[model samples]
Target: MADITTPDLPHSRHWRFSLDIEAIGWLILDRAETSTNTLSQEVLSELEQLMDPIESLAASEQMRGLVMLSDKDNGFAAGADISEFDDIAEPEVLRAALERTHRLFARLEQLSVPTAAGIHGFCLGGGLELALACHYRIAVDDDATRIGFPEVKLGIFPGFGGTGRSIRQAGPVDAMQMMLSGRNLRATQAKRIGIVDKLVRHRDTLRWAGRKAVLEKRRAKAAGLTERAAAMGPVRGYTARKMREETEKKVRPEHYPAPFALIDLFEKYGDDPLAMIGHESDAFIPLMNSDTAANLRRIFFLTEDLKKQRQRGSSFKRVHVVGAGVMGGDIAAWCALRGMAVTLQDLNMERIKPALDRARKLFQKRLKKRHLVDTAMLRLEPDPSGRGVARADVIIEAVLEDLEIKRNVFADVEEQAKPDAILATNTSSIELERIAEGLKDPGRLIGLHFFNPVAQLPLVEVVRSEHNSDEAVARGASFALAIAKSPVVVRSKPGFLVNRVLMPYMLGAVERVEKGESKELLDAAAVAFGMPMGPIELMDMVGLDVGKSVAQELGHDVPEGSQFNELVSAGKLGRKSGEGFYRWEDGKAVKGEVPEHADLQGLGRELVVPLVDATEAAVADGVVESPEKADIGVVLGTGFAPFRGGPLKARADGKV
Candidate 1:
């Protein structure tokens, strides 16, 4: 290999080209004016122009190999610029763009010298597709290094030659699974699955590893016998049928069509890479222009907008959760997982032990590594004597939903907590004003209401009353964001935002069940309308006792003779007690079949109308600041049909 240390070569706004000491041409991606690199039209066009210099280097025998990497520390690239998708209204226009990208990537793939992608952080969607185009992919071994084709999440599949190349590299089943599910693969997992050729210990060594892999002419992982067999016509059909069957179990074709379309693509063209590449846009173009795609993209932007509400330079580091029940324990554990020092205060260690146990399981599932799980466990301390109150930077009370109990907790917390420390309550339905009544400085108290099963739900209702200071409210919202939850600041009121909008919907379902509608049929109706679960199923998950309490607090009429109350009185509380409207087994509702002649569509409209009405009233009464905030809150907090955008959005679009 010749040693050519050139300072300059191809010039472009989004790419840097130079020859290193080892005669390797390093093409560094640094999208101008952005913290993260994305493959925008200008970026991709600049890359094509830069390819001229790359080919010249290879032709002159001055380059040993080509290594592509990013200058951005956050990621190699966050994928294609999604903002551009809004302008693409026609399939022909999108097809033309896809064809151009396919041509450019093909040029990179056919270059004389071996090419490698030095991947760090996230290489997702188009970024992953770009990596697949390279001869080799070398990733840094770290938690941040995530690689995947996440286009399916936006109601599309990989278009820039990913469908064919990924299957060629990782084999049909693994590649299809990665594309269909839109789940990211860690560096080690990527290496095992052949998406990555090698993994370096650190980002500093990524270039060296890429160079070594290129110079040594290391052969990429070849598909095994099983992989090859799976791609055969008969076998491919069987596998794709199985994939569709499994996918339909999670999402229906009417709601999410990308996964099914991708399965069909694989079944028809999995054997021939070239043919698959040529036909890729046939499936890709239509899905990109779909209503579901548009709504999902809207949701993606909404989520990003919410993240901007995070308070920078927050002084909160230590969290004290005063209760060891499900919500409190989970909240404390989540804080610990996010690198906060959390102290869980309860009456005794016995109560705290279950929380710790649950946290251990959550850690094992999320962190995956033993050392990381251990670190999280060490951050959570059990304080039976309430000693953490004096040292905590933020004190969150998650005790029982009794007004006096919460007031008493705050009275003690106000005295022991630091004067400037934030005082928050995780009250689901109670007004923050009532919770702050006994406090010496009520203005310092804010509501940080997290939904049940804190780990799964993303929304946190940051409730503020007339008594709360603006700084207190800002800090509460910041804390929610810091813990990786989307915070929607709502005025303190009974059933604030999500629960306020959700109560009537759940109660309406219960009322219909009492009037002779089948519980399973009603649930099916909700599912057909795109709700994640039926109201009955959700009530069961929330626990019937808890549901009845929130419903009453929200001023809904829950008649004493109602099935909901009757079931609660008989000790069948819900999933917690293993029985309600539906029997619970292993955390799943065992629902019976819906009747053949059930009016699912009519029932769906009837069930969803109350939710839409409540959302309108909540926005009108100023519970949330705007319709957009209410939409995000309902969608994330209660799983309110994301494809419809939200209740407010659905209403505006006349989709409800």
Candidate 2:
């Protein structure tokens, strides 16, 4: 009675390959109506016409090895479908579709017999360049797997043949700092950084251990004679002049030309895996028509269409949280590190044991087991009795921004929650209708704001309030995409959309340091106008009295009688009182001299055109519905400049 009509596909005419298993010739990518497998230039032209009859069955011996699985239960592809980069917006049809995906990964690296891949979930970017032209890969000891080549977070690089098979198997400074810090790793750190070649421990034994490491011809695992003598030759010219002086001190190779063209095409093709696959298909065909990789592939299809329009099909078991501080004990230890049973109340049991010792030091720096931070502190309970907000199913309220103490803590969380729970709020500058006035069902409240060390920023915002309810803004955008974060639904104004487009670029860098300018020429003109920390050293690392009380709680203006109230009346609260406007010492930021006629590109366009006109006036005042969710809420809540994709596509490409 529970069969659900859809099980006839062992191989009904190879929809994205399916050879099954004649001693592991599995192939099977399975992309029909997709739930993950990506590489779509029509699935790399039907995987190059199904690898020409499996390369004529490995040239007649009827294939002894080949795996590349993924009938998607998790995901093995997740790459190459920047919605087919709008049908190759011509850089010679995106370098002839990246030279037909490098002649189908150089015909699966000249497969004569053994070839592998397996992976379990998210083998990213051209699916880790088809598991590095397969000769082995394996993966699957799942915490939902992960391997990499995150195409430099979509501003592009790793244009298939993943920068010459991750610098010929993990050399060139840990494969160019894992493709210039796009960072995925975790399949036991991609098998200790040789980008995985075996970690199986059952995902149905990754296609029988990737066909027993391709009929025991294993090979693929190189780089260690001290990572091939620290990338060889004159220590590869002092590691390509210290990765081009640390990628031009935070990217400015003419505004992000794919991580300085993947460190100048691997310092001009050293370790030549076929000249780094023709300089990664001529630097990914004009960086796939760069407007910074089409605004970082339109913020990777708007955070994958806001996780399918914020699904509210319910599933957030328990979760209480009410103010244990440090953003409610890191949002109750990131909802007990995502499995959620959380609780964390806090009438101070030493503030709920330092949010259970900062959620057991964030699950001992992201779980590789200290008993999975004791199974995420056995789902972090610590209530100190508000009776876990009447058996919470979502209560949040990380209190103390004050609007009558968050309307008397939402009238005692609408008198102890759960009448179909959900009452969110982590208020990063209030106004979800002023914390839903005196809430007794301000349509079950909402806002889920979360962003300050809430397990290291991935922007939550959810907001919504005209007294919420479209089922409480899809249950606060389904508990901020069920703890993984990225939410962005916005609209309850006053500093809602990323602190109202970052309180006019931090009160216009404190009115250019009270009109004299030099916080080292406005933090080196916001790291030469790309900004990953500059507006007065991000308001002295977010504490010039918490950026002047969020620019006077977002009403903004802050000009008259200034030097920002004489550096907050001389306590100089920044870097925790080390001193504001530069003087932190051993903890860095030591700025001083900049009056060599400090125009600094007109003070970085007067602190980036009022943060690109307050993100096109927050998509023209609906507070966020387009200009791609106010440029993915100021590029994931005020880090902005994801190669200038936010701030209304850097003010509609005039690049602010």
Model 2 lDDT per residue over 287-336, tens place: 76778777777777787788885564687788887778778888888888
- Poorly placed runs, candidate 1 (over 4 Å): 1-10
Q: In candidate 2, where is summed lDDT lowest over 10 consecutive residues?
A: 1-10
What does the lDDT come to for candidate 1?
0.88
Q: Could you give me the TM-score of model 1 versus the true structure? A: 0.97
Model 1 — which ten-residue stretch has the worst lDDT?
Answer: 1-10
lDDT of 2 at 520: 79
Q: Pick the candidate with the highest lDDT.
A: 1
| CA-lDDT, candidates in order | 0.88, 0.76
- RMSD per candidate (Å) reads 1.7, 20.3
Record all residue pairs in model 1 with backbone atoms less than 3 Å apart, i.e. clashing. none
TM-score of each: 0.97, 0.36
